[model samples]
Target: MAAEAIDRAMGALIGGALGDALGMPTQLLSPTRIAELYGHVEDFVAPSADHPVSKGLPAGAITDDTEQALLLGRILVSSGDRFDHARWVNALLDWERDVKARGSYDLLGPSTKRAIDAINDGVPPEQAGSSGDTNGAAMRIAPVGIMMPPEPLDALVAKAAEACRATHNTSIAIASAAAVAAAVSSGVAGSDWRVASDRAVAAARRGATLGHWVTGGDIAARIAWAQKLVRGKAEKEAIRLIVDLIGTGVASQESVPAAFAVLEVAQGDAWRAAVISANLGGDTDTIGAIAAGMAGACSGLSCLPQGRIARLKGIDLAEVRALAADLVAARNAKAGSGKEAAA
Candidate 1:
């Protein structure tokens, strides 16, 4: 059981990285442009000079989505499962500095960049992200779900919020992130894909209440609606539904639901789900990363394509696996102590 759990965790991390890398080159292009340029982007391609954010990035290089996830995983292991918003922000600043030094134009999301700058200008950490309503938080929040103890949905929501409130405190962002995290946590613990999806929906609703209320549609409901659109449809039709109906923007409502819909459409096949997400055009990397993360968690590492796995660059799968192992250990210890305290 322990070995199997570790495998699922590895699958989530590696699968997410694969999706991020595969989608990097075509991230911001419209579907029409993608079709005009490459017909279909099923393999890794280097970003052309005309590419928006990743113009000069090497082929198969991960973007901020995967990079921030690795940073969050490191913070998880180091903080012993306690996420500190200040610490997370500091790490992002460091990452921005390093990326800038390397001359990469891609650095931070608009919401995240603005929030961090506000924090730097003396806004309190909790207040830093109050206005952020984008999907930035949800994109990197898989680790929180991976590391959190199961049950007590409230605790899971709280931990997810702790991880997200550094750059996205709005209910929309927090709820979307919680949904992703809950799915990953449940998936890693041996739940079936449907079970994990249900957990995610429930957690998203719960998480929305935990944050300062912002008038918005229910993220959980939107996810279910998106999933319903893919049912009984062909893969190509479902992909079109996701792109044309659900949208593929940076807004939590758009990208998060699109990720869930793609995962449902692919029935948790990591490669197919990631491919669909990568081809979704706008916010491709982030949507692919989320879908791939959930699929990977449910299916385990062996399900990922070996060719793509071999081509992963700039990120360390071994380290990601190690971080997952440590998070499991930390969660176990915390759970054991809680049991003892109850006794």
Candidate 2:
């Protein structure tokens, strides 16, 4: 229940990385093709050479989903937990350049790439993300949420929105990020899955008010529908329904709802959620990362496998744990400052 509980924070960061690695091989592939090739993936698998972005990635190798999330976490820690859109944009560009220099083809998402390009072409950083409406913001937002506690849903939504501002400024995108962040924050505070879900929805609705100028469909309504559709269905059927009706594509409208549905079907089991998401086909890594991150926040480090976490590449668990702690400290201190001022 304490913000200092490293287990939940570790669970969130490592769980998301594990999910990204598990789903990397199947990302952007069709469900039918994934079934034909891997036949119910239960563990980490090498990405096929077919997808150019993920080619040459070994088993247990994480993709941009985890990489960008870690980058965001580091940015948060370095900035004293402040959410600065310009700094976020600059960090992402630097990260992309570094990744490219390393000869890795796994690169930025379409929305993000374009936003950054626009920023480079003389557009202000704040104005660059206006065109973005993808789930890129929500995919890496667990760090922001993990640093927060249960109360003050408005501040959580605001921080989530600010985190999204670098590449996804639309209402749906911001709201989706808020939902994921709120879920993780509530879960880390020891709330049950049902309570976390309620907070997620409420925070999303509250975030939408902050984005009144940005046009998009209602994330809250979509998540509500997704929750209903997967309520009593079996795993396979739930996957089918999520893919067919809710969708699992790269768009915020599709992936965010699908992630929530996947988490619901898994009933807050972090490992099961990751497994389910890895086999769900389109944008598998991002969906798995989002769902598993939330489930991890709820279940903590105990639910994840140590062997698998040990095999994950490009991440240092100890460093991530430290950053999570620093973020918690920074946020609490800010909250305390606000309370003192209020008095």
Candidate 3:
């Protein structure tokens, strides 16, 4: 159990990195083009921006998936073992808000990048996120599940939804963020994929506001539908359906559904999931990153390779370390508070 716990945690981080780096080269490839270019991006290579790694990343480097997740991890440490929404939001805001020191170019999704740009221009933070519906929130949300306080799953889901407002605020985006966070947390708690999936869907359902663009039903149903659509269909056809049926790219509609669909495809194979995620075309890196993180959280770290971790860029490494340290600190604080989840 201990080993499994560790591995699941490792899965989230390593899987995220693998997906991000692999998709970097083909960030904008159409599903058909992706299949033609590579059956699936299986290895770590620095794809030129036009190629895949083009999201302003270095060879063998990941994107905001690792960076933002690390930020959440660091805040969890400061959270004293439980969530403090303000602190979490502030942490994310600080990192992305101070754009003078930009993270890797093209690292942040358009919604988040635009929202931050709005905040810098004097828009209130709350209003800043109103327009963002990109996958930015979903892509970097894994750490919240990894180390959140153990308690009411519903409340945690709400928190996750609200927490994503630093960048994303649309109901669909918020729900997607909650799903990823809840799924990761369920994996941490040793639940199976179905349990995790149920919790994730339930969380999204709860967080959804009336008249929200994407229904909980839409997100959940699409997973099954994408699988059926891809059956005997060419890989390109599968990718197209993901774009047409589920969406690809950064829109919350595209990101969350695409990630879930690709996740279903990856099933239990860490490498296969990550590779296919990138190959599904639109927002390939983001989809791959989210699925990969979920895979890591559900599986164990042993399923991933150490070489990939070593190959990630130095900046990303430092960010993840900070997040991990925060996770440990959060546990310690919870212990001191007499309510640590570990107890």
Model 1 agreement with the true structure over 72-150: per-residue lDDT tens digits: 8788778765676777899999999999998877789988998999999999877888888888888888888777765
Q: Compared to the true structure, candidate 3 yields what TM-score?
A: 0.81
lDDT of 2 by residue, 1-343 (tens): 3443567777788888888888988988999999998999999888777775778878998878888888887787776656666777888889889989977887888889988999889887667788788889999998888766656778788888877776777788888999999988887777767788888899888877754355656888888889889999999999999989988899888999898998899998878888999999999999999999988888788778888888888787778888777766765676677788789
Per-residue lDDT of candidate 3, residues 98-212 (tens digit): 5327544554567777877777787766677876666677787787776653347665665676566656776777777877888887776677655676677777665566123
The runs of at least 3 residues in candidate 3 whose Cα sits more than 4 Å from the true structure, single-residue gaps closed, are 1-4, 35-40, 49-58, 79-104, 149-151, 210-240, 315-322, 328-343
Global CA lDDT of candidate 1, please? Answer: 0.85
* List of clashing residue pairs for candidate 1: none
RMSD per candidate (Å) reads: 1.4, 1.8, 4.1
Which model, 1 or 3, shows the larger lDDT? 1
Error of 2 at 64 (Å): 1.0
Using TM-score as the measure, the top candidate is 1
- Candidates' lDDT values, in order? 0.85, 0.83, 0.66
On lDDT, the candidate that comes out on top is 1
